[model samples]
Target chain A: MSEEIIIAGFGGQGVLSMGKILAYSGIMQDQEVSWMPSYGPEMRGGTANVTVILSDERISSPYLKVYDTAIILNQQSMDKFENTVKPDGILLYDPNGITHHPTRKDIKIYQIEGAKLAAEMDNKKIFNMIVLGAFLKIKPIVKLENVIKGLKKSLSERYHHLIPLNKEAIDTGMKHLKKFNIEKHIIHN
Target chain B: MAELKLMKGNEALAEAAIRAGVDAYFGYPITPQSEVIEYLMAERPEKRTGMVVLQAESEVAAINMVYGAASTGKKVMTSSSSPGISLKQEGISYMAGAELPAVIVNVVRGGPGLGTIQPSQADYFQSVKGGGHGDYKLYVLAPASVQEMSDFVADAFDIAFKYRTPVLILSDGLIGQMMEKVVLRDQVERITDEDLIKTHGSWATTGKTNRNRNIVTSLDLQSEKMEARVHRLQKKYKQMELEDLRYEKIDCDDAEYLIVAYGSSARISQKAVEIARKKGIKVGLLRPLTLFPFPKKQLFELADQVKGILSVELNSGQMVEDVQLSVEHKVPVEHFGRTGGIIHTPEEVLDALEQKIITHGHFRNHKTRESSIL
Candidate 1:
């Protein structure tokens, strides 16, 4: 199946890194993947987004329409990508950032207190990991072991201590997001 | 051989040039390509790699330095972006006219002016067709990967020295920024001080003990001599076409639609081709590794096989014209791109390809759509 996703937020929110991790994992799994970012002034601030597509076959273009999934880290990102989500797509959003609920009833929207969960684990920066955990639970593209391996590779040498906390945050997010999987009736017509 | 390190394409090019025994680097910093200069500067290759690095005041001065160094028969090089490359074109032409061997890299960016610092293949015509006054060609290498950037540096220098011409590494920001592992060369052959070309001995100066030596200027007072010079350069270019047109074809043997792209845009097109393949579409990619000595023959052969050709680039229909010229109207040539700072995604390319099939039967009008910022 063609799984096209866009992870968007401001700079330093780990949006690009999250997308990179996903694309890199897909590559490791022998899945065809493409990752295109808003590699412009948006990288400096305003807004940042990366579109990732992982398919069983080669990816045609890095551009997207009716993206199968989206992870919005901030309210601005949610507003930007909300309209583009496919009817059967899953949107994992940061509850702290997105105050307003998604208007679309066709798509499944999961709200998680990512920052709070990560902060409880003593590293707020792992909010992306928390959201990533939610993504792993929903998408099931790469196994958790591969994601952890990719995460370890992505971490800086100095920040090596944070991996355990990040993993904990992922587990927390996975546990929380697992409740949504039961409703097979929620599938789009 | 060790495992490949995830290094940016521009950095890899710098390391490759050093390993290739490039004697000196004279360049100005421009985004996408600035990392190359930074890599050289940080490494301070003088003691280790035996090369001199200089950050020039302007691209004009940098190209002039390259011209000076190359005349000495040294493997000198320089790099810049589109606007900066435009400034260096005059010197590039001069190097070509003097038959000096050197390498110039143009890490292309969107522009007519100071366009935003991003990946662009708009300089295809600028690099292939002479950007400066006078008829000349710089053996241009368009690398699609950081690995190829390393692979092509030595080849670029070899071609330059072989033809007594300037060679260009025509890259874009995507390749410049993206990291990939590269297998580096072990031995580096550096030019010694003994090998320095003392232009003081040659007629590089007018009054230097010459008993009235004829000027070796591209400007020939006699029309016949000028024609001969042009013919000579043309012959060299012809030889290059026979020997140096490097390209990669993937799944193109039975492609219904062929996507012609190069450099970073070609990498994105590779992703797009994969997606199209999964959909049961017989799509293929023709990635040009050498921009100049344009791969006309391979493109023509593909035109004979494919239903139609789609030229994907990061510019406003620049390479499309070249593809048209190559195919010679044997088949319809369409283009898809996003200019300025925007990068065309694989999905957009797929849409264009699908549109090409669904809309017009075969003969398609050239549609140049302005890319919107997302």
Candidate 2:
């Protein structure tokens, strides 16, 4: 099964890095993966996003207007991408930033206090890790251990000390995940 | 032998450039194509093979520097997106006029002017019909995937050096953005100054030489000589029609209808062909991977058996003209597509085929519509 995902947030919020981590995890798992960023000017300020496509077979195109999953870090990102989520897709958002809720009942919505959880872990920047953990809980496309390995491999020696805090943030976010899955057609057995 | 690795389009191009024995790379950073420069900058193959990579001030300077490097009989190339490719047209025309061998890659973006950073095939006419002044042709190759993107760079250089002309890789945003598994080629033999028709000498502004002053200038005021020069170019182009034409034909032998498309558009067209066959429509796809030589002969041969032709593209009927030219008055060549950064889906092409059947019967006086286009 192929899973196409979009991760969007403000610049330096690690939205791009989050997508990269997911893609790297897919590659490590031996799945065909592609990561494409917003073409040009869309990368500047308002919102920065990346599309990660993980598939068992060859992927024809990287451009997507409708994605199977979207992880939004801010209200603005949720506002921009909410309409584009495919039917029965998952919408994971940071409850600390987005006050408004999803209007679509068809989409499985997971709202986590990502910023607050990261602050409790003594690192607010680990908010991205919170979102990643939520994705792992909802999709379970890759193993949690694989993601941890990917993160450790990607982190530089200079910042190796932050790995434990980041790991705690992921665990906290996963613990708070409230699955709103309404689709019984999914064959998880 | 190298294993297939999932690589981005630009990264593939960089690996291909090295395998193609590229001696120099001159380019400026642009969207969709920036990864190419980044890859080359990081790889630093120049230290091992005497290669040189320079980030130029602009696309114009880059192409001119390429022109200079090519004149030295070195394998040189530059890559850019639509806007930058437009700026390099002047230098490209000069390189072509002087019969210099150089490879230029344009990772196309939407535009008549600063259109957008998105993927586009709007530059079809510009790349094939000559974007610069005067009459000229760039040997244009369109690859649909990252694997092809990696494979075509070496082929582009080989064709350029063999034909003594500028070769263009007319890649779109899809090819630039996508990632695929590509088997990287090992180190290959390099071409030196002595391998070319003419190298740096008194004519190339190279310090000194003993032979008659070779003139590399494109300005030939003498009409007869200029005419003769053009004829020679025409003859070479004609010869290329014999050796350089390339296309991928799938299930065309017994098919009654043919779809003509290229680049990423053709990839979807391939799936459409499969869909049509399952429905018993007897449809096949003729993908002209090389846009300039166009594989006109294949279209002409299929025209005799096929009922009609459908030309698909990312623009409004640009490549349709080429199919029409090939089919002549033998069959109808209908156009289908959406332009301006929008990609036409496979379902849309299937709809176009059904529409073709609805409007015109098997042949439906195909002669008349054919004449209007050809």
Candidate 3:
């Protein structure tokens, strides 16, 4: 199966690195993967996004107009990418800073208090890892072992000591997500 | 040998150059390609292999430094994006005229002027058709994948030294910035000074101890003498055309239509071919790996079998002219592209194939075809 995903947020929210770790996990599993970032001047403080494709076969274009899943970290990313998810696809978001919730009936929507949980854990850097954990909890396209290995491969040696904390954040995120039923929301609307 | 590692295209090229025993790297920083020099500097090839890495004041200075080092028979290289590459044209022409072996990488961006820093194949004419101010050809290699970006560095140097001409790795920002897994080769040793003297001793200006004085210049005042030199260069180019033509044909055995592209466009068109096939349309892709030697013969032969050809690029219409020239009106050739940093999607390419080449039967109207070719 091929999974195309987009993760978007502010510049320092680890959106790009989360995608990189996902791609590396795909590689560890001997799958074909590609990671492309929206680079350049916009990466300073503006919204930054990365497209990650994991496939059993060769991947074609690194850029995509639509994605099977979108992991949005903030309201701006949620506003931009909510509609880009394909029908029956997944839209996972951290609802901490989102003003408007997703209202699509054809796809699955899930929310995680990633930023709030990371703050409670006293480390804001694990926000992306928590969100990533929620994505895997819903999809499970890649094994958790592979993700740990990917983290080892992606992070430099000096950052190795933080892997356990990151792993704990991912587990917490996996348990903390609340599924949002779009059908119920649509009927209420 | 290094194990498989995920790397960006620019970093892969830099690592491959070090493993290929590049004697020196002289370049200026440019977006989408700065990692090439940055990686080299961080790795400190000077400490590891005694290789020289210098950041020049400008692209012109960097290319001229390459020219000087290549003249001494050392394996040297430089890289830049489109605008920076434009500044190195004069030096490139001088290198080509002097028949010096060097490698230049162009991580192309949107063009015409200082356009957007997005990936583009707009430099097709500049690279394959000879960008410099003279009648010289560069051995242009277009790499579609990060693996090719790494492997082609060594291959380009081999071809460059064999032909005694500059070779260009024509890539773009997409390949430069994206990350993929690459298997790096074992490190090779740089050629010793004695080996250089033994191989290029005749023409290289390495003290000229026993033989007559060696001179390297593109300037020959006499018209007839210059004409003779041009004829010799033409002969070399002819030889290259005969020996170095490289291309890849995908799913063409039963294809009724063909899409021609290179570099990043080729990757996208390959996907288009798959999508078209799934839709019951027989489409194929012809990707030119070596743009200079340009798989013209193969394209001509394919033209005899396919009903039509579509030249897809990321430019207004550059390589389309070459595609048209190759087919020689045997079948209708049309161009479809998105310029100014916009890359065409696979669905768009498939739509163009159906709209322009197949379903509409646009080739059936001879008058329309003639006008379109013009």
Winning model by lDDT: 3
Candidate achieving the largest DockQ: 3
Instruction: Give a tens-digit lDDT track for model 3, residues B134-194.
Output: 9999999999888899999999998888888999999999889999888898898999868
Q: How close is every model to the real structure, measured as TM-score? A: 0.82, 0.83, 0.96
Local distance difference test, each candidate: 0.78, 0.80, 0.90
Candidate 2 structure quality by residue, lDDT tens digits, B1-374: 77556577888998888776788999999987999999999988786566789999999899999998887677899999999999999999898888888999999888878887787888999988978987788889999888889989989987887778999999988778766556788777675444443433233434345556556667789999888878877787887788998888878989888888888788767767766888888988888878988888788899999888898888877888988888876877788877777777676787887787435745555557665678
Candidate 1, superposed: residue stretches over 4 Å from native: A1-5, A19-35, A52-69, A83-89, A103-108, A137-189, B180-226, B275-281, B354-358, B362-374
What is candidate 2's TM-score against the reference?
A: 0.83
Clash pairs, candidate 3, are: none
- The best-first sequence of candidates by lDDT reads 3, 2, 1
Model 3 residue runs over 4 Å out of place are A186-189, B199-201, B363-365, B368-374
Q: How accurate is candidate 1 locally (lDDT)?
A: 0.78
By TM-score, the better pick of 2 and 3 is 3
Residues B1-374, model 1: lDDT tens digits: 43344456788899888888888999999886898899999988897877999999999999999887776567899999999999998998887887777898988888879987877788888888987889888788988776788888899888987787889989888777765445677647785534332421333322335256524345677989878988999999999999888888888988988999987778778878887889999999998888788889889888788878889989889888989889977777888999886787777888887886435634353322111111
After superposition, which runs of candidate 2 have C-alpha atoms over 4 Å from their true positions?
A76-80, A105-107, A144-172, A181-189, B1-7, B42-48, B178-181, B188-190, B194-214, B249-259, B267-285, B301-310, B329-332, B342-374
Let me know the TM-score candidate 1 reaches against the reference structure: 0.82
How would you order the candidates by TM-score, starting with the best? Answer: 3, 2, 1
Name the better of 2 and 3 by DockQ: 3
Q: Please give me the total number of clashing residue pairs in predicted model 2.
A: 0
